[model samples]
Target: MKRLLVTGSNGLLGQKITDLLVQGQFPNFEYIASSRGADRFDAKAYHYLDLDITHHAQVLKAIETYSPDIIINTAAMANVDACEREPAKSYEVNVAAVANLIKICEDRNIHLIHLSTDFVFDGEEGPYEEDDRPNPVNIYGEHKMAAENLLQQAACPWSIVRTILVYGVLRDLSRSNIVLWAKNALENGQPIRVVNDQWRMPTLAEDLAKACLVVAERNATGIYHISGKDMFSICEIVEAVIEHYRLDASFICKEASEALNQDAKRPKRTGFILDKAYEKLDYVPHSFGEGLKLIDEQLAKLQSS
Candidate 1:
């Protein structure tokens, strides 16, 4: 690859990509990391630019200016309830932004690797395969599925990576994931109601990052399912977190999905059958415990730092 540009450079997966390339994975490829605001990543090994993918003119100009060999689009309005509350805004980011990127990539012959979620499936029958028909049950899933549809029709070379329940700690701590949330709640002995009805194969941000680059390096095409090796209910996943940290589990109140009364209706079960990602991308994800162990170390390091 001549040049690889990543959007949402400040995000967990994007930062992990930067970490990889900085540590000499694909050392020769010129890297560009972009996000809407100022660069948040601490590494200066690669070029950083401010990019808001939702802004059409700016995105068009950036693509023309940099003309990267590959562009990994990781920026999206991912909050399900947020998407439900504000659909037009969500579409502008999730679907319309992707359309712009596809058009630009189509024109420039730049390979586009877009991040999607397992939510594309309705959770009626999953773990889903690569060719499984999408029937998104919520607005967020609908928009992501819509983006996937756009990529499928696009003339440019493209790959869609669908992941689930991504979790990891970053240097900047811009956001939190379920693992950390559970850890903190348990630490404080705060009673948190966690849903037991929903199930997922949680993904590590680093694993997802590696999977993306693997897809790009191997020139993989079509949809790839990338996530953790094991599946668990949300409550079980949290319990694992508590066990890993040796925190109090009495704080966790196991509850059904309906009790949460979330603004968006989540899928009952949506996991991916990763045989394609394994055979095609040579992708191997860490087990849930393995992933949590890494995070434990990272958290300690972060505390020290």
Candidate 2:
């Protein structure tokens, strides 16, 4: 069986991928899911480890111990505002860690699958293509873009999957992801102020996880923009969440600017053109409407449970 190492295995995307793998969504692979935490699992195939990739020795040790044929790096310091505040720590984990992983992967001849963000673009004239030049407005984007550059310069084969506005579990229980924030706000009879000016293609965590598996299996190298089909503003998405949850539509108020709360400058638009993913990976991204329905269904189940 081909062994695969999935980093950030406890994170939102990582957990989804782990579930899919565990439930036999992807067959014919031996999976090792590592996180900074997580202890329990049903079987021995799941090995949870405390991996702080900021330390090169720890990273190298993990890779050497796993000896995985494929390495998926999902670990990153992705808090946008936090990144702006702590740019050095962000670079250590987001950029330097990736560089170390690339070195190990190259030496071992392992296929490296790296996750990136749409934030890498400044969002100026967005719906960016694979070949578009990246001009990041914030430190988070800078770190992500820097990592992408490092992976590109590496000798080993690597696949960079850039996703936007990922929503699903493992995001903060209260106010982590945009969709959930809207859900909780409406549930608690509170109003939400979402920015209408910024636009992005929101990707579901499940879809991204499946896409990652596809990209890894195909060994497709270079950058691929895997995002939702339609573009939406933050306010529009919040509205969709409200509508889906049967909440008061008026709960979500549109804000003209995110500048007041946002510590770093955000781009007006930063979605992607995914024809390359379709052509190469045979990837069929979910439309925003369809994705919304899925999220609603999941939320409903959670409520009932």
Candidate 3:
């Protein structure tokens, strides 16, 4: 049997992937989840290792020990503003760690599936295809782009899965997503300012997790644009959430991109075309409404438990 390892196993996508694996989603492979700290999950069906991908020696040691056939790298310094604030830390985690993984994969002949983001695009175009040029506007995107370049030029088997606006719930509530944030804010009757300019096809965490598995299963190569099919401005995204949960939208205040003096510049209109994924990987994503329905179900389960 083959062995599969995932970094950032405490994250939303990681947890979702773990959830599927526990349900026997990939019975042919053994699942090993590694994070920077102690395991946050309650499930014991898979092995968990405390791994900081930033440390080259540590990462090399772990890989040497685990001897995984495939590695899904979900670990990243994902916060745009945070990356902008701390360039050194961001590069260490996002770029250097990937270099380490690539080197190990090259030596071991391991297939690598790396998670990326839509922020690599400049937002000048909509529904980008696989071969579109990348012009990252911020530090986070720059680091991710660098990692992609390394993978593309590497000798080992590699796959890059780029997604947009991923959102979902974790049992520990360690992080918050757009859907959960909007629902909670509106539920509490708190007025919110949502940007009307930025646009994205938000991805469900579970859908992305499944996409990663499909890529590993097929050992798919090159870039695959994986995300929801629909397009919506940031404001429209919030409005849809409001509509889905039957919440009051009177407190929503629409704002433009410039007015929100954010630390990092975000792409104004960057969504993926996903034709290659549908054709090659046979990957299909849920609609924004359908994704919201799943989120509601998960939320209800969390509350009941």
Best by lDDT: 3
lDDT tens digits by residue: candidate 2, 1-305:
77888888767888778878888877867888887755333345566677777878987888888889998899888899999999999988999889889989889899999999988898889999988999999999999999999999888989999999998754223226887777777899997777889998899888899999988788889999998888988878887777777899876677777545778889889889989988998888777777777766776676777
State every prediction's TM-score relative to the real structure. 0.98, 0.94, 0.98
Instruction: Give one digit per residue, the lDDT tens place, for model 1 in 170-253.
Output: 878787999988888778888999998999999999899999988888778899999998989998999888888899887888
Steric clash pairs (candidate 3): none
The residue-level lDDT of candidate 2 at 229 comes to: 82
- Give lDDT tens digits, candidate 3, residues 101-212: 9999999999999999899999999779978999999999999999999999999999999999998888888879888899899999999889999999899888899999
lDDT of each: 0.90, 0.84, 0.91
Q: Which is the winner by lDDT between candidate 1 and candidate 2?
A: 1
Could you tell me the TM-score of candidate 2? 0.94
Error of 2 at 207 (Å): 1.0
Better of 2 and 3 by lDDT: 3
Runs of candidate 1 with Cα error greater than 4 angstroms are none
Candidate 2: residue 163 Cα off by (Å): 0.5
Query: Model 3: C-alpha RMSD to truth?
Result: 0.9
lDDT of 2 at 295: 69
